[model samples]
Target chain A: MIAADLAPGAVLSLECPTITRTALALYAGASGDHNPVHIDIDACRAVGIDDVFAHGMLSMAYLGRLLTDSFPQQSVRSFEVRFTAITPVNASPTCHATVTDVEDGHAHLDLSVQLPDGTETLRGRAVVSLP
Target chain B: MPVDRSIIGSRTPAFSTVAERGRLRFFAQATGQTDPVYTDVAAAAEAGHPDLPVPPTFLFCLEMDNPARGSFLSDLGIDVRTILHGGQSFRYHAPAYAGETLTFWTEVADVQSKKGGALELIVRDTHVERDGAEIATLTGTIVVRDPRAGR
Candidate 1:
């Protein structure tokens, strides 16, 4: 598995536009988490935000996509992440991942999500088990 | 007096967890996934999948009892709502296709104190199989924290 071959400090980053509405709709539909802060722009702005925000899981799913794509040969055995900040919608968001450690058949990665303004939106880690 | 760390090693019993088809469809629809592999069995085979397959996150819908249910953590004075999603990990030996009954077992691995608050790590694992063939195993972590005390 490529996960077994990754060296510590290996990093991957991607910058992409944020589809806030689509993501919130998707997560709300998928997880049944229909919180207004994700979909209601007016509601979001009521609390001093520019626009609606993406669901934490949507950003997490992007990390999931990263793990599955990076080590296609390996089945992800474990993953963990913390939502540091809100991911704003209708804007661009950059996502990155770095290999932090590999031991006992597990590859650990430090991940982050950022906005164009250089705001750090999320930070977390994911571990994959090698085949 | 400090709590006993011995309870961390307790294991939960394996049991049959229901996978509701309608809910799976709803979840798939919500995610904007339209693949026939997830909605139709025959189409899944036509697409080369063994059976109808749900998305990776589908496992969360199944509410299984903790092996240490009503014990340990809560007994030690932990609040469930203060807990947040730590992360999820899954291993697929084979695709867990739809229409198949799946069984899973879980256990608590460890718990430790973090600088800001107590981070209670509970590992809930599920091993899925069909007709004696192992299909997948998922290990998920739920991090319980005292949100009121954290930074």
Candidate 2:
């Protein structure tokens, strides 16, 4: 979609599947970030965390999905996120983005990932160029 | 154990890796990115990309290819068990695609203490390039808790 065609406050959303232990393990292998806190429940307990949690990058990846699914990858000029909270196992998360501004063929979006209860796990923004 | 601020300017040797198609596909699937441009070259071409485009944030994963990836923490006397991913950011100058050999260079950007020295934060910036042309910059912050602080 062209930036000029996007309206300010236009929001796009994606419902992510429930995070599972198997998925975490898969991400561990795929991303080569074998942080035990994301895959080993026993290790998580030892570290004073309640249970194995999703990788913050995983949440960022979900937000990336929201952008790539909408704009072509090449059009994405910048994407960034800050990990705000832990996404617990089995948490059903969703990604949302609102078109905040469009200027000179560039569209800016405010993005976030949150649990069903509205607990935000990640917050971010992206700038995309319209083709 | 407090992190020594002296290592803030340290840099790791540069490394390079080819963005293999299979690996890109696996990452897209793992991240639940259903975009075909990330997994199919033809689809990517149809979408105005030269080839399967590397998804954002995936560069952070590629930066891990550095042979000394784990040495930074060990050299700082940090235990891997006590660390958490604090934050991450990326700036893209150009799109990276599958089959491209991308080089990465990383340097420790900053260090700080929180909670009366119980938690230490280390920030690093990685530069990515293809054939000497800049592709992206990855910024990451890792937080480590001193076990001696006893929570």
Candidate 3:
């Protein structure tokens, strides 16, 4: 149970919940990240953005699920992400993991959250202990 | 206008928050997490956790528990309207669980201006501790675009 049969070249993926206006609202309140750019259309327009977008943290949270689903939560030693693009509302994001290295009882993996159109919303890395 | 480099090294007072179950479950639901261990302690215990393990990235939510969270930006005359999240990272030295009281404090690690001063980014490192021992560190970048920059 401590290991996930992972190897240096293994690839893992999971489709996350499609982002919607309702999901944005719920996240805004629950995470206390009430950035109006994520929930209010008028607010988005005020900033010249045509439509509200998903919070970057929301995408990062979904990416975390990829790790949890594959390995035990406690096994995750580090997680990181760079916000590269905006995830417009209604976009379905997919989380991906590719093992880059396995050593010293841990697996180092490259991670990403990408949209259906192939836009990578987030990219980064993670280190997880196998034992 | 670029963010003043002097702001680097500014630190926030240490604050504390409890990882309550209700908020954890709410966050889990909001993220569309179907895993029962994140919501049910019994399931978490069955999974060998002492309690509901703090889901990855949830600590960022708890980091917002710093009561003066907004002061850092507000005090700098930065309009919340012009801000965006650039990127962030986390390193966990130990697993955090629900019901544990964790203390958090942040320091401005660096400040930079990019895209010809159209964007200013503030890098912060937040330290999360429990029982006086460090459990996690979160590094985040807050981007503030000059509203007048006109893209």
Candidate 4:
């Protein structure tokens, strides 16, 4: 949707499957982040973590997909996220965005990634240019 | 040990990568992005993009192409096991597409200690450029926890 068509408070959402160890392993290979905490259960325990968790980038990537799917790629001018909490293994996450502002040819969105329990693990915003 | 504050402002040697379509497709699929514009040239062209558009946040992955990617943490004597992904941000000046060669230059932007030096935060900013023109700026933070703090 174009910025002109977006109204403040309009929302877009996407539900992602449970984050699996295999997915994290694939992302490790794809993204070149070999951090074992994201893929190795033992490594997580060694580091004082209860278990391996999803990479923060992986959730950010989901938020990216939410934006690209709603608007054209060239229209996105900025995307940002702050990792707030650990996304545990096998947790299904949902990404949500609300049109916080639309003006000067830009649609500003407040973005978030939340676990099934409604705990927000990632939060941020994006600015998409109008076509 | 906390990361050395003196490392702030240190810059990494510039590096470049050709945005290949295959890699873009792999990233799109890996992230569960079903958008055709990210994987199909025609679909991207139909959407007004010159070519397959680089997915947002993928620039963070590209920054990893720097051969000295891990040296920053190593230089601080921090073990990889103790690090946590803290946060990340990207600002786009222009859209990047597949097959374009983009250059990246990164600098350590900030460093701070928290919880009585039990944790450290390192922030880095990377400038993404193409043909001498700016494309995007990526900023990321990594948090390192001191395992011996409580002991």
Q: Which numbered prediction scores highest in TM-score against the true structure?
A: 3
CA lDDT of every candidate: 0.61, 0.85, 0.89, 0.87
DockQ scores for all the models shown? 0.21, 0.67, 0.72, 0.72
Q: Docking category for candidate 3?
A: medium
How displaced is residue B69 in candidate 4, in Å?
A: 0.9
How far does residue B112 in candidate 2 sit from its true spot (Å)? 1.3
TM-score of each: 0.59, 0.93, 0.96, 0.94
TM-score of chain B of each: 0.75, 0.93, 0.96, 0.93
Q: Model 2 lDDT vs. the true structure?
A: 0.85
- Docking level for model 2: medium
- Order the candidates by TM-score, highest first — what do you get? 3, 4, 2, 1
The parts of candidate 1 lying over 4 Å away from their true place are A1-58, A62-131, B1-4, B34-36, B40-43, B63-77, B116-118, B123-125, B129-134
Q: Clashes in model 4: which pairs?
A: none
Clashing residue pairs found in predicted model 2: none
Question: For residues B1-151, could you state the per-residue lDDT of candidate 3 as single tens digits?
Answer: 6788997998899999999999999999999898999999999999999999899999999998677888788888887778888999999999999999999999999999888878989999999999999999999999998544554
Docking class of 1: incorrect
